[model samples]
Target: MFRFFRWFRDFRRNRNHTLSSSPQPSDKARSPCNQPIVEATPSWKFDSKARWSKEYDLSICHAEDDIIYVENLVSYLELQPHSLRCFLQIRDSVPGGAMSTELCQAVRESHCWILIISPSFLKDPWCWYQMQQALSESPTANGRVIPVRKQLERKDYPQELRFMYGIDVRLDKDNGFLKIKQAILYYLEELCAKDREEQQQRDSENLVDEATPQA
Candidate 1:
């Protein structure tokens, strides 16, 4: 009986020794899908000399903070089947909204504008300026200005932005979130299609330039 007990102890110690001898995998190698974090450096591209050159591919300006609605909007975009390539300019990324040069630049360069007009949004100057800039940049009466009203009325909307089509996403904060989600998805799909068309147009121009006479 004593010999059997000693044998079991020795076996266990040998198993542990063998396990310890085996090299542990590094964090990156532990998971086959592990990818190194790539730092996002700004690769700015804009037409400096095009007859009609826009500053951005597709820019979107939104205010985010304690508002669940704003966060939800971002969350929905993040989960899209077709990725939305956009930057939301804010003061802080972790806690939320803060106006800066980024916010201003984003507003100026943006093709798409998402205004979350809660009661708190009205008193803010940055949001107001962004709306102004968007209108100024808009080509005609039929301009693309998307409003995501968190909680506000027509009177609350910037006078110039009033005529522009709005998504009235306040319903998302109401009884049914699905209906609101579907509506925004439908709208975003259209935006995605428009971006595709614009991209194709840019590609065609590039091909033409290559084929044309060069000095």
Candidate 2:
């Protein structure tokens, strides 16, 4: 028994010595538990492609009186560096198409809707209809609706739009438009992040399936 115990102790000591003498990767070169470190690849990049299969980046819902001003805003958005596709009922609508169909499609297909809440807009029945339609499409809002208050009074602010924050362009058109552009870009980036996460999940699932053995 004494000899057996001695042998066991010597074996343990030799094993320890052998392990200590073996060449091992440093902590910096290897992960915890001696696993090889793998550098994570970047999963996303900024691109000009449409986000989430949306047809247009922005849909302008405004009164006929605001068409000229909306056109200028559209031009700014569509120009280089911005290059945002916008749905304008006046400019992009099919010729002889029903007005209701055009308005509904514009609100439905766009990633975001901009309600130009000018005085004329408040008075226009069609503008009010579109505003309600936009709200119905995105009840929680969720960065989908933007209300631009142009030459409108505080008392005249639409009751339905009171819940969400809006940009007031009554004072500075350039500054307001810039803010609008930034908001749209921010929303698009968020959508892109979601898309990337979904893609990563799919890739991981594929890898798991490939590694799984057949019965």
Candidate 3:
């Protein structure tokens, strides 16, 4: 009877020891936050002009009569960080005889187009062409076109522009300028968000390719 009891006790002890010594499943491995760590890509360090010389943050399209106002606007924009590389015909020294192919290309490359509307501006055919091209490139009016009314009423503007909200600099120059700056900043923020999403997707694809087995 004593031997049988001792054997039973030893069996229980051995079983318990074996169970404790065996490796158990870890919760850490099941946690998503602890799995599949990915390293971030290093940021490219280069001058913005060197990286995107042909592209511009904003393009100002206006008639020769409004050059002074455009210059003032450019000066104000230059105070901002990313607005240093604005495209303007006068500043760029585009050929004065006629609108060249380079000029049109510049307008297309611009992320945002600002039109200074005035009596003279309406008289110029080239200005109208620029407006048409900008609208075609960015169909979403809220995203691209920024019109600054100098001495025109909403009714006097084109039917297409009449419905769109524009900054009226004729009445209040300061407030209108501020609104233009705010619009540029808003558009730039949207562009940056899009770039970040595209970069993340590229990184995830690269990681999957790296983990795939070779045949």
lDDT of 2 by residue, 1-215 (tens): 64564466446544644553355545234422233333232224334244747667889999989887787777555543335678877656665567898789878889899999999998899999999999999999699999899889978999999989999986663637666766787777787777778888989999999999989
- In candidate 3, position 212 carries an lDDT of 100
At residue 159, candidate 3 shows an lDDT of 66
Give residue 21's error in model 2 in angstroms.
68
On residues 1-215, what C-alpha lDDT tens digit does candidate 3 reach at each position? 64564466446544644553344343212211122212122223212232353367788889999887787776556441233357777545333334566567767778788989888888999889888888888777776799888888777787667767888986663636656766876666566656666777989999999999988
- 1-215, model 1: which lDDT tens digit per residue? 64564466446544644553354444213211232222122212212232123333234444445245554444333332322233444312212224454466565654455566666677777677776676677645433456566557767776665665665654533322233334434444455556667878999999999999988
Best by TM-score: 2
Per-candidate TM-score against the hidden true structure:
0.49, 0.75, 0.69
TM-score-sorted candidate list, best first: 2, 3, 1
Model 3, which residues run further than 4 Å from truth?
1-54, 95-98, 171-175
Please give the range of 10 consecutive residues that has the lowest summed lDDT in model 2: 32-41
Listed per candidate, the RMSD to the true structure in angstroms reads 18.6, 25.7, 27.8
Candidate 1 vs candidate 3, lDDT winner = 3
Query: In every candidate, how many clashes are there?
Result: 1, 0, 0
